[model samples]
Target chain A: NAGVTQTPKFRILKIGQSMTLQCAQDMNHNYMYWYRQDPGMGLKLIYYSVGAGITDKGEVPNGYNVSRSTTEDFPLRLELAAPSQTSVYFCASGLRGGGDEQFFGPGTRLTVL
Target chain B: QQQVKQSPQSLIVQKGGIPIINCAYENTAFDYFPWYQQFPGKGPALLIAIRPDVSEKKEGRFTISFNKSAKQFSLHIMDSQPGDSATYFCAASPITGGGNKLTFGTGTQLKVEL
Candidate 1:
């Protein structure tokens, strides 16, 4: 089903620059999440959506935004990037929320300088 | 505060040996605990999971042992192989609320030497 897919497998941005990390899932999952993984660390949630038009902040949502306009799409936007934002970003999808199995995409490695 | 904590930042074991990775959580509301395995350049994939109601769960060569009172859980790889080497993450989430957002532990890198 191609599960979940993310664009720009790798990217580098200058300070104050902006970019969008695109994600899509063919599984028609109703829940999608965006997480960042730092070196030697686990994932930290940036933002998530229960469905199209419903988004919420997660543990670390600063400097980022998200939009889920369709069941298959959820994109994360980084505005005025900073070096602290350098990390690997992952996009995941699930048929249901709360303890449900989440399918993850290969992730985009982002570097902000 | 880090709700979930994992130990052994890295582990090396010989093939056929058993490698156990441990995790602990502080949230009493968390009911579901899961372990994810990630290979280089790839996203994390679900390995095995356990609910608080069960003390243990096994799937193939992987097993999850849970201690409800201690709020701790562990993953054990039996007869480990080089192919089983990967970064393992432990995560927890409540079943009802917060959109089931997961709190993850710092990963443990596992290496199996032949």
Candidate 2:
């Protein structure tokens, strides 16, 4: 399987601009997640979905949104981007939601200017 | 609040040496602990993981030691190599609320010199 895949390996957005970071998994995972990594800060969950049509906020959900339209796709949206949003975003998928192995995509490097 | 804490922002060790990275957590609800390794410009990958039930686990040259009473855990790399140089992260997750949503600790950048 391709596992999890994310689009736009890199991007730079102006303040107030918006963009969507796309994620997909071929493993048919029921759980998908969005996380941001800032240098030594490590990964922080932004949003996650238990399944299609069920999305919830995570540790750092502000300034972001997510939609899981299908088992394979979970896309993260950044609206009115700010410089504070500059970080590397990752998309991950897992067979189950609790303490299971998560497969991560290469990640998208986003810079808000 | 940062529920997970990792130590040593960076570490450098020679090849064949054993490097240990430590982590502590404040959440008692967390039952699963896992470590992820990220290479430059790439997403993190699961290296090894352990549950609180097990005090220690070993997989190949990577090992995880857990101290339930101390709420602390550590990862040790035996016979480290240059290829093992990467950012390592310690993460924890509660059993409730879709258990896979992890809270991560600050990463430790490890550099193994040949």
Candidate 3:
């Protein structure tokens, strides 16, 4: 069913380069989120959307931006990416109510040189 | 405050052995507890979950035990196999807050060897 999918399985960028990480879901979920996983930092939320056209900042939103253009697409943008921004990024989606499980995308591993 | 805390940054178990991972939460408002499993390059998947109203929930080889008073929960992996080697994460969210937000633990890396 392609519950959730992420693009650019892997990428490497210089300290000042910027890029986008794409995430999409086919379950018709209205809630979507972006989280980054570091060695010991668990999963830290960077941004989230309640529905298309609505987005909000999460715990770790610095140096990152997100937009919800469609119910199935939420893309994350990194501006002036830094070495500290290098981490594995994950995207997840679920029903708005949220007691239900959130389906996660495979992940995007980005290395900032 | 970090709402959730997970123990044992890493663990190793022999095949067929039982591996347990514990997690505790400080927010009493959290009514939902979920465990997620992540492979080397994959996103975390919902392994099992339990609610405050229930003491335990089981699905095949995985189980989640919850304790409301202690504000804690745990995941028990029975008859662990080599393929079971992966990272486990514990998370908490308040059902009242529309529940989409999940506060995750640092994670536990489990290695089951033959």
Best by the lDDT measure: 1
Interface root mean square deviation per prediction: 0.9, 1.2, 1.3
Error of 1 at A101 (Å): 0.9
Ranking by DockQ: 1, 2, 3
Q: What CAPRI class is candidate 3?
A: medium
Candidate ranking under TM-score, highest first, comes to 1, 2, 3
The residue-by-residue lDDT of candidate 3 on A39-97, one tens digit each, is: 98799989989999989888889999999989999999999999999899999999865
Off by over 4 Å in 3: none
The TM-score, computed over Cα atoms with residue i paired to residue i, of candidate 1 is 0.99
Q: Pick the candidate with the highest DockQ.
A: 1
Identify the superior model by DockQ, candidate 1 or candidate 2: 1
Clashing residue pairs for model 1: none
Candidate 3 per-residue C-alpha lDDT over B1-114 given as tens digits, one digit per residue, 9 for 90 to 100: 677999989999999999999999998878888899999878999998888889999999998988888988999999999999999999988887653689999999999999
Candidate 2 DockQ category?
A: medium
The CAPRI classification for model 1 reads as high
User: In angstroms, what RMSD does candidate 1 have relative to the true structure?
Assistant: 0.7
Local distance difference test values of all predictions, in order: 0.95, 0.93, 0.91
Candidate 1 structure quality by residue, lDDT tens digits, A1-113: 89999999999999999999999999988999999999877999999999999999999999999998888999999999999999999999989998888889999999999
